[model samples]
Target chain A: MSQVLTIDGKDLAFDSGDTLFDVAQAQGIYIPHLCHHPDYPPQGNCKLCTVDVDGQSKCACTTQAETGMSVQTDSTTLTEYRRALTELLFSEGNHHCPGCERSGNCQLQATAYAQGMTYSSFKLLNPQRQIDASHPSVLLDRDRCILCGLCVRASAQEGKHIFTIAGRGSDSTLAVNSDSGLLADTNLSAEDRATQVCPVGALMVKQQGFRIPIGQRIYDQGTIDDLGNRRPQYHSPKSKTARIAGDSDD
Target chain B: MTESTTDSRSLTRVAIDPLTRVEGHGKVTLLLDENQVVQQARLHIVEFRGFERFIQGRPYWELPMVVQRLCGICPVSHHLAAGKAIDMLVGAEQLPPTAEKTRRLLHFAQVLQSHALHFFHLSSPDLLFGFSSKASERNIVGLLEKHPETALKGVKLRKFGQQLIETITGKRVHGSLVVPGGINKALKPAEINVYAKQMDEIIQWSTEALELAQGLYQADRKHADFGAIGSPTLSLCGNNGNFELYHGDLRVKDIDGTILLDHISNRDYLAHIEEEVKSWSYMKFPFLKRLGKDRGWYRVGPLARVLNCQQMDTPLAERARLELVNQCYPDQHQSVLLYHWARMIELLHCAESIQQVLKDSELTGGELVAPHGDRNPECYGIIEAPRGTLIHHYKVNDQDLVEEANLIVSTTSNNQAMNEAIRSVCRQYIDGHGVSEGLLNHIEVAVRAFDPCLSCATHALGKMPLSVEILSVAGHETQVLERTSQGEIQQRFYPC
Candidate 1:
């Protein structure tokens, strides 16, 4: 029999190198996440998918699944932590849902709704952010960026290394790799996989906004929990499997 | 307590703060002597919102979706105006035929719904019941209780308009449909058929509403003189001098029905109109440049449009327009109360127009965007909103961000007209009478006739409470009465 672990009191078989999040996802279980993408190496920075492993808390995306291990994905403490993390993400960014083109289809908005977050409890920063619209077809509005680094990883995977996170802590920002520090000067194209992975409205394909009317967009058709992080209509040819399986790269 | 003191020469200032049954916060102050003879009357706009300043540095294409936050009642007007401005900015001088028709459908829906809301829900209580009726019983709720069928019709009519908007744009309010050059989506045949089925019922209801408004105006001869003022009127008329709401040349007609100005392009508005700033009010007074400040002030909205336009395009509304012109022939109709009648006529026109546009096959499929031409740095977009002409001017930088924005909303155009109405009402109803609920409502009724959206004019935000105060000329409070936001009345008295 394959080595087994217990997640939320249910038995799950996992390969030796499979992470807890990977094993759970293989079993059709969802742990809320923002910084995790199946094609990229796991980054536990968001801490939204934190789960109870035995008696200690750990990020399911980064934690290795061990035989006979007991894991809990849902608990009062986990819910509070997840909700607070989502609220903090909202407070940090200028995520105006109604005005955003990604409004109904946005992952952050859908995740917030899943957490029942009507309003942010934390003080809003309303941080002034830069916009990079110099590109012919792509726009990088830092105001809506959550600094999840998915774009950074996807760009690196494509060998373009067009995006990166610069600075640290509250001063950290989504920086484009270009001599002029503008998206236009970068080699990034609208067809780049990195441009399609933005969970918010930050990295948008110019002139293609609101093309899919609201109430017909990705998240509008179903909740984030039900639809997962897949954007069916915007999937790249290389990521067809990932779109179908929600998170699996296979 | 003594008659000598009661008849003292010191003027008493009566103030109605936070006037109700209107869209935004406004106050009316009238100065009267002991005999209650009116001396001075003023309408004050108390709040200020700087939307233009904040819109700077934003991408030009975002204007249509962004500027719509100006008002909940008329977001579509702002959306269409900004879309038209952005169309010029992007150098799409003319839209695709399908795009133009789609926008026209959206605009007519907005006008139909907004007019239905104002006439049936907001002002019907005053018309159906007497204007002097008790405040508690003079509201939409009271109207519903007394006439459920009429109330239901109003609600349904508004719903149909909102539903049509949703069908076209997606959401009922603040939906994103317009893009820089044209609309984002075209209506499927099924969607157009949804509204097409309801056209006859909507047309019938609009005709009935028109009849009701006409009946009310004819029944009351006093309406002819109520808040009546003679001022020049302005609107947009097509190249053929036909009544136009979406796009046309600016036309100004004198009080005596003579064409004072015609065929003025919207792009040259600054050369013709100037806005004056006053110390007491946050709202600006826009006047015609040629006429000067004192004589330049003019009226807008349904009365102005009906008086200025040569003819209505639709057959039914054309007949209604002829009847109105015949009634007020030889002299322009200046009665503020007639605005209700004119608005109903437009509402009927919108209903008929909606049906006409839906039958066009171009709405189902065709080119949706025009090829952009040479981009312009600055441009103006002007449209006749339900209330009146709304102008949106913008200057964009090299980076395609808005460098400057100037908006003259419908209410701002009517700011001077509203103040004049307040003065007229004070002179007629409160000149020699003590402050009473009935008399105060007459002042509100006069303002309501203009349907001023103070929120849009001042670019402000917030709700209003009703408060009345009596003060001596020395600025000492003599009596104070307040109606809280929760609709509770509280009174306090002070000896002068």
Candidate 2:
């Protein structure tokens, strides 16, 4: 039941119900992604992972892998598109990479580096953003948020429903689920998946800033191309049956 | 905390503004009588970071990380001190044994690297070359050019310490590993084994450094009398009266080596010490409550810690201390210049302590953190940072949002004493005539002995202008020299 597809003129095989992102990841090909964690349901909000499939532009995260479907991941047009997307993200927020604690490890920053983006192409829109520090174990700096909705999806999957997206277009913003609109008012702990899911510096675990020194962070060692093949260390909990099966072997 | 006395009708002011060779922005203003005798000397902090005001809305857990941004040199000090304070808020009476040992090891590494930086990089340039050495030949570059091997050794030693910090906490400058209750990760067996293997090398380098410092001092007797002045010493020591750099109870010793106050809890620092604000400086002067302002002012740092401690924790440092106190300088090692010697002794202690902590088998213990309950409203965290005692106090609400904060850093603790030391040096050197470059350098050397970190002390952030002014007898400026750009220092000569 295996089928082959061509990606960037290279033949790759995948089973049924496989998305382009899943196939690419399995083939050790990095398509520069955020808002599409392997463990969480795909949101396809960020267009950084868009690929040209059969002469049509489509988000690889939302597209299904088809037999003999030709896909282009790297090209002059695609490179410019991803580069522009990275620039837009940088310009929309106050992303002072030098001052940010997550500068070295941030997915947006790493993706930009992977695309050879030396500087932003668009004018920086340094909007005044509110920093929500009402939580005991987390700090929410909206200024650095790219509004990918990973936290919103990750927390919802954990049944906490701690985050949501409000408004539309340029006015859209991240919203808290609790009545008090503070993390301390909820049962959120430092170990929550939501706290660990933010790919940016927007949602940071307090007291852990700069714990890892510069030039030694995960992304600092190598490009995402090298690290993209490895499976994520953290993932969603196993099902009840899977857990029982795993325990029997132990 | 002396006034500038600009209003004085008949006083000549010699202003060594934009003092060089220290951490951050500062100026020394000396008021002179008609005979040019020093009337008063004041050290002014020109910048303020306002960290306390901005941290208000930040969560209590973020305090440890946010406070560290206050200083790049001693970020680990603020990091650990804030962690301890937040630990109180989290209701952890004591951290897990493994967590405590890991923190101790991290702190020792920090101390080792910081002391190495202050000695080999900051102060040793003046000591190895001369206080009056040409400005062109009085920097790290000059040290590299003159004594390449020694400078390399210092760099290697600092790298060893910094690597340990990165290995344990995962970052060199501001790593976010220590949580309120405990450290996020335990020291791996492999990490400990590696550090344990390097212990002998660290010890040897530190021993050689101590010898070099002693040699430098003996070669130049003039340095001893350069900025020599005695004042009350203040520090925090363990219950056993041993030298403590990480955590301890506040202790004050008179200049004559008598314990004036002991065993005062850190929670009551505000009750025992009060800050006096001057109009000319953003920095505050901290004085003991038992004595009035003039008598209560005390000096803190390696000099105070060396003279006040009953004994060092490690055997090598203790032996070094005995030699310095009894064999080298019998008069209790009071000279400001001798602070370099005290710093070297501490460096040895840190190296030895690192070995001891790493050798402990409990370092690889499985328990990394303790259980912390609901948050409290307020708490205080205090520790002996590389500079001296640092205190972080915060008030928070039920949601863990900070409402108010107060920080008392080490350099601020020595503000009054620094001014007095500058006055003493000026009295010994400067006259009615304008200061020569050498005279200005001597004053800087006196300040450098304390290894003052004014950036953290003032908590001021943003662009700061540097200026030096010469005032006439009527307080009118005769000449004003301001640094036009940051890079201007490289082109400008220190000695004119």
Candidate 3:
């Protein structure tokens, strides 16, 4: 049934084509989601981009635009759901932001940082994901992938058709799918436009690596603040210990 | 790259590919006659993209990311401009004192790095190799052979600046760190002492560099005559008449040395400044409509900054300022070679200023941001780009995302002026019946003198080159236009 949703006391009408996340952003409410870039197709893989739709939960990225549907994108209840989701994503993935090349600009690191999720309370488990360092301009570390599907969509849709998903479900691994299993073996150039579109440090820019120092970036605090006090806010119940321990908190 | 000269000349019809003298991107052409006079000249800055236009619908918080893409070398310029613009958009200028100092120090670091790149990599070849040397080794490699110690100092100095940025931001290159409300990270005093020590060595290098740069013009006649005496152009910056780097009121002057707009808010930059697209290239020409076409040959950069400022601040710069003015015009030095010398003077000031700021105990973490909460007024941030005055203007909707964006980069301001510069250089060197590769290479290098990064200067994005042919009152002229590999073509034309 179609319904006008009142979220944080604002009237919002959900139509057939509206994503709850989209509606929330339009209403001046920010929802923290790393896997669901506004520009990329929603994976609902991280499940952090979840929102309450009508009386249930929905992954805002994959959820279809609907008509007259009431939606709640932010609240204490939803925040907890998001915290749990981001926490899991962090714990399941291997994210050593300080050591990662994409620490400052990595969406995963930024999300974890923004959500205050540092070290996982869950045992490291740190299952291994294959790391392919052969590609000159980009690398693939399966463990850090988050399986967000941003690289896949960007390469396939935005970049004419260089990348594809060969396997389905949990067996999924992003493959070059170009007759060869290697990235450097493909027709990709170092200046490949799609490769630069990655949200996390997963697809690292090869030539630009290790060029600048730690303290003097062009934008400073992960592109959110200069070198001063307006520090970025990261909160994740998963890494609650780190926040209190100065690793996650500003 | 070919240009045709005829009864009517258009700067758009010529192509000077692989512009020799600039830092990031270059190549321009001037169509002229047998009389050695230019009929038309097209400043074919073949790297252009619509970055401002691209960021139109992005969330305001995403501005730092978008604007930082302006220049790979000068990203700090864009970051600060965009951050200040957001400050205006959300009315959050009340950020605590710590935040302001953080930005100021970061900005200082960038200026240091950018100037080092310009002086050591872009222009040092000329300074070290004798401006008129016919040697093929006209680059950093050449400078290394002659002055290895100086070359090493240059690398370390630029590195120090980038190091400072990385330590605070977490990454050196593309950082999503700083924003409108406040700084995301703060510096520690203990670590800063390490930075200060390195800065001391850089200061020594800069002091020596100043002497070397001044000595070149004084002793070398061919270098002096070739580097000096160009048509003058004003570089506008903040500060009504005060000399400052990062922020202040703005003042515009003509190449003839007349002040136009003084103390104007960056919000009104476009209202006063008009950007014209030339058919020859992707780079746009920004002209003062009030001054009209040929007269709007205003430029921004070290030369322009020193000229526009009425008084000086800081002692080191003041002494160098006195020495630099002696090489000014009426002395007939059209070399445009003054960029290296001027940059060194600025570097001296930046280092000393860094010392002063480092001494501040208030630079520690606390009260950095004031939160985003307010109206959607058109916000504009106009600050001094290492190349010149840079402006970032944005109009946001109620949701605090960008409704529109317009950037007036330092390079854009000098587009018309650069066109003139190429024409003058071509007349001086390339206008004969035949042009050789080495000489032609030098002609392009002359344009490089300004370190013209059309990708940066144009407030645009990306580097794409397209060769086009245009037929007009003159004849068939080949021009290279700036286009993206994405198939986006940006062609512009300059008027006489």
Which candidate number maximizes DockQ? 1
**Share of true Cα-Cα contacts across chains kept by each model:** 0.30, 0.23, 0.12
lDDT of 2 by residue, B1-496 (tens): 2445545667767676565322556778877777766677877788777889977876675677778887777788888998888888878748888888888888889888988877887778888887767555666667889999888889888899899988876678777666667776777788788889989999999999998987898787676676676677888898999999877888888877788888988678888899988788888998988897877888888778877788997998998887776633345336677778888998999999999988888887757656776666678888888877889988887656788899988888888777777877877887655456566667777777775454222211111234456677655666555433331222122321
Worst 10 residues of 3 chain B by lDDT: B455-464
Fraction of native contacts, model 3: 0.12
lDDT of candidate 3 at residue A4, scale 0 to 100: 66
Across B229-290, the per-residue lDDT of candidate 3 in tens digits comes to 34435444544476777777667755445566677666666666777776766767777767
DockQ for all candidate structures vs. native: 0.33, 0.21, 0.07
All candidates' TM-scores?
A: 0.93, 0.82, 0.63
Candidate 1: CAPRI quality band = acceptable
DockQ winner, 2 or 3:
2
With a 3 Å backbone cut-off (N, CA, C), the pairs that clash in candidate 1 are none
Tell me which of candidates 2 and 3 scores higher on TM-score: 2
User: How many clashing pairs in candidate 1?
Assistant: 0
TM-score between predicted and true chain B, model 3: 0.84
Which candidate wins on lDDT?
Answer: 1
Give, for candidate 1 chain B, the lowest lDDT window spanning 10 residues. B455-464
TM-score of the first chain of model 1: 0.92
